[model samples]
Target: MVHPLAPLSEASAIPRVRRLSDRHIAVGERWIFSAGFNVRSDLADTGRVDVELADIARLADAGARVAVVSHQGSYRDGTARHLDFVACHLTALLGRAVRYVPGTVSDAAVRAARALRPGEVALFGNVRLHAGEEANDPRFAARLAMLGDRVAVGGFSKAHRRNASNVGVLRLLPGFAAASLLAEAERLRPWSGRDSGRYSVAVLGGTKPEKTEIGLVHLASTYDLVIPGGAVLNALLAARGHRIGASVLGGGGRRCVATAAEVMARTDRCEIHVPRRVVVAPAGAPYSPRRVVDLDDGVPPGHAVVDFLLSPWARDRLRRLAADGGRALVAGPPGMPTPAGTDSWRALGRYFSAPRVRTLLLGGDTVAELPYEGPASTGGGAALYQLAHGTVPVLDELARSAAHMSDMPA
Candidate 1:
């Protein structure tokens, strides 16, 4: 795979994004605003919905007809595929009625969008219900494009996707990115840059071992120290010739361990700390009472690693690192979101919360698992993708569309 980090000269070549703030919204103009509302399965917790809400209010309050477009993952095998829940939340948050359109890219949706007067807002149904939405079919893009005079994308979680609603629609209509989305990109960009003098540490872990490995390898180049936890901790242990027993090695299993070994070999610029004491349970039983075990003693057969507990000596090291006044970045949860696993996340959170260690948190699980909120990214996977790969699909589309608009005759 090509290295995700580009030379500074090459990075400078990427076009400047056209933001919604740069556009002049004429009253009554139709705006198809794509937003991300699928944070949790039940949609009970609105992660970063307020950001999109603020942008929508800007357009609606300016007398523009706003039509919201969004997609939700299939719940329990194709159940609960409507946007009414989001509409309800938006209505309450916006302090106004948010009309719910029954379908997307259908005649009824078009009619509802057309019927909306200036300053009114309506949310269309989940676009994923239609096959073309994910396929990025031009026909679907054209239909969605017709729903509005311009497109405003606010779905940072979906920025990595090349769907009709984001990438395809940009090709068919004038496109502008939401301020919140741009802000997310700017915040995550620093991790991929050249290392500075200030000490920086990255705590890398998550349910996805493969992604964690990728992040770990990249971060080691720029950070002063790198710590592995969660499934990543398991893989690194196996790489170091330790018996992890039946611990979760992720879906990749042996392959993940191999990659972890390779990453450890290549990353010589920074120090990597792999916790010796970990919380463990019976292989197939996560609900069982967990016990802390030292890796020096082999993990008993039929058991798996679940979480980590920093030894007192290691804790003192972190405290000293904090006192030096540096920065820290946490990408994923150090443990599973189980009663036993929460301990590790809490411990790491407390350490990073120190005033001297300015912390930057990324990934949804980190936010959901941690007790306190700091600066965080709502889209975990997307944020990781941008961090590793430099740019996302939505940002590229926004820049491309803006460039095309500039070249066109007035």
Candidate 2:
């Protein structure tokens, strides 16, 4: 039951979860879509939520009653956030009324879903507000299952989590992989460990050094080379006793540096290319005449490493890989925007977007900065977690459920 596009090394181990399009989508059938609508404090970036639109629209167009359920904010912070704005945003994008169901798994929410007609869509309230969702309570799962006849998992970002909406609901109903989730699995083909025996490169960056360090270990196994940049590079430099000055460490502190050192010590599977020359500027201020100095030249007392310029040696390696038709993956921004308004994100963006290099970009900032018509994912954490570990928890549950219901049509 492996996906047609999934790698054998990984996919063969999991039971098949049928795609939503393959199911008999009958009119008036209730379709519960589990999606990730979590937003930042600023609420400006809705890409994670927006990516679910196509599949949601697909279900509605097929005359199915649709209910989108997701958490809205960081549940760890204990701050309750509503999905009122998400419903309104969807109404605008869909050009149709999307009823906002103000409770999750509550009697009122169940009533709202039960009242929906064919082709109608509703956005359920934040699932995290319910104590049972995060706990994956069976009773809560039964309550949510009452809203729909089938389940569609469209949130790849939450696939790794074991939550009521993610793993619990599948036990009670037919489950299928939504379009976006399938797209994510397909785009991650590079990390499938298929053993092409060819050159592949992974460029690691992003603000979270701890997460990036974990991905670096996994990326090294799948890719022939692992290149570090951004805060990840800063941590690596610090691990090797190089002075990084005032550059951001993503708040991981000494633990981050220790993790990087550990990775450097144990990583023997792939080549790690650390930038020797870097662009530097005064910390917290834009200064004229930016300096490109060697790594040996420690960052000055009041300065920080702004970006790393690829040496001819590293550039040539990438060029050779491209010539050999190998793939390249960029996880996060290689550099941050300078105080003076210049950005290095575009520099790496241009290189990867070239037609010759088969590229895939992960992370929201990566996709936002470089909008290319190729493999990309906005869920950096989930994307990396899957790449590192071959299976996602929710997807695995859905696969098992699909296998159990094999006697019935999808």
Candidate 3:
């Protein structure tokens, strides 16, 4: 077996990364990564999966003796498949078999990682398996931090939650917390930078309105165009006094609806576009007859409108906007598109890939629905970013982690 400390002479697999002339792990050097892959079945195609794979590959290429710390799933989703899924990817990305240590980043886990041969990696079990993780207990962070000589955060999806793996361990690292090879964090870096001359657009959707920030009132005031879609559209429609029939409302519902109406009515800076047409299913049936209805037609009491009414008129206006240049933010989906997968996502994919759209972002459930190869964040990060006018605490922590690197006594 190759000695763990022997220098790796191989070049980096990632583009433009400088080669490690001598990628040697001295007595106790290891790259501890806070990875964000969850056990949810969606890991099969989500953006977090895509980005983390690249990060792991890069770290492996850098010849770092790596320890991947990941969430198996949300705290309650204690499914073995989740750990099995993440471990599979870790092994593939590292190009060598990985050892699974079923414990917190406790002393045993640390010892197991340290014992690996050069190029070997250890994937720790769900950090959330331990009680101290979610509570941000210092003892947990300290224990987890002991596993590595350095730390990097690879789980962009989990950044919003200040957990033991992502936030706690960083406090003890000597310098900046290393970033997983992140690309979009920079694109979204200037979230708070404001310019009245700049044009912006935001599209808010999804079934759970509770997940949205009423601060969207601010986005409505700031952007040039605001389109409400999915179930949120039902709220906006109701706020505008349109009949939504039996469509379930989400987020702020009546209150949020009223506020949005007032903004659309009063604000000159932003124009709110509610779909005049929508996709509705009769009686909310899985195979119910679905059709596009005019905004005034309303849903029948037993029926539900599940998708944005993408009429010829609606499609034309949206494509025009995409063809034009500006910043665009997609909040999320209201509920699943009714009648299965026909309505919502195809049009969204077109706009997401449109070249002239300039800045494109998707957050919340919307991120999962459309898996385009681009920078995106989960609903939590997206909501906070919108509320803060683009500032994300996780991203901010990543930014601040650098100061610790440069200013602290090395």
Candidate 4:
């Protein structure tokens, strides 16, 4: 009888894999997976772990020898968080204690690969631990190539970064393909189905304005309506010459705001709408003395706009925008003050859950806020930026690999 996993051998059957590499090892035989699990402005990587869990199961089920490489926490952090922490997160989800090996290219690492028990995974040290991973060093890529016969680039959130693990190793692989999770994320659409032919709305809400610029422009250009929230909202309000008072403005939002203005001016179809009311506190006192006020009433100079888009009028507006929807890409939610902000999340849940809604692309922070769970990504700004632009180099190559394999004959 033919081997149950023999179909994976078809990569050689596909001409591209042969052209890319002379190696004969199947995809499941030995593989290096460069995953992206970094967070956006909110410092949440939970979604990243959740997404990768699916890939782990698939690779394990295929009886593949997998070496999972990922970056954790932020670059700005004094030190990279321990890889064991991520192991903990994955362990909870997989319901099994995963095997972890310390070195990326040590002899011991090779031994661990040799010892794989068919469905077990061996997660390598954080890719960031290796000094050359992010530099796209050819030497580092070569070292990683020593482990895997083929490469799979599935970190859609991390695809934008030209790190060695993402593209460099991909270049070395005789052939490569997309991880099932990353392939799913790459399909993110700005507007879905017949709704694209009609009016569509987008929500760009995240803590950092600088990071959200690309998404803002793309949303403004694609959707009929663009709604700003959190720091993005403050910047947009200021762009229109509204009295911002002392609201928290994300550093470097003006560049994005100016870009949005230019796009709005030229694209008469896209509209920018502001909330009639906002929740505010004394400028320096963001936590206390909070109250709601109509924008028409005017805010005091010492007051800050902590949250908005949860008032009755705001909800009604959201209801209409969300009604008969086309597609919604919510990066995150509007700023909320505890008990006050909680209602906004629930309201957002109701709005996005509308039957007319065609698509919803949610990022990490936005995913956490939703009452109803959906596929979310950890690539944060990088993920949004990738979606706005066309195919990423890493994922693009992976697609080519899959296509090539599909074209091969038995």
- The 0-to-1 C-alpha lDDT of every candidate, in the order given, reads 0.77, 0.76, 0.59, 0.61
- Model 2, 75-153: lDDT tens per residue? 6658758888889889999877999888778889899999999999999988888778888999999999988988889
Residue-by-residue lDDT tens digits, candidate 4, 1-410: 11111122221121121221222333447766677656433435465656567656666667777777777554444455547666666667777667777786677876776677666676777677766777778988888777766665566666666777877776666344444333444445433222455556567666765344676766666666666777777777766667878887665657756755565567443666577777788877666868888787766788988777554555665677566454555676656445445444555667777776654555556666555555455555655665566445665555454444332211
lDDT of 3 at 101: 83
Off by over 4 Å in 2: 1-14, 38-51, 61-63, 77-80, 92-95, 128-143, 194-197, 209-213, 251-253, 280-294, 300-304, 339-350, 371-374, 405-410
Candidate with top TM-score is: 1
Residue 71 lDDT in model 2?
Answer: 79
**TM-score, each model?**
0.86, 0.82, 0.72, 0.74
Any residue pairs clashing in model 2, and if so which?
Answer: none
RMSD, candidate 3, Å: 7.4
Ranking the candidates on TM-score from highest down gives 1, 2, 4, 3
Clashing pairs in 4: 157-379
Report the lDDT of model 4 for residue 145: 75
List where candidate 1 sits over 4 angstroms from the true fold: 1-14, 41-44, 74-80, 189-192, 251-255, 267-269, 296-298, 311-317, 338-341, 406-410
lDDT of 1 by residue, 1-410 (tens): 11112122245233466778767667888899988776554665687677798889999999999999988873324643777878888899999899999678898889888899999999998888788887899999998987887888987878877889999999978778887787777767655544575667788777665455567667667677778887778888999988888988776677778877887888365777887788888988877888888899967899988788876766776787678767778877777667544677677777788887778877666777766667778777677667666778888788777767542211
Model 3 residue 56 lDDT?
A: 54
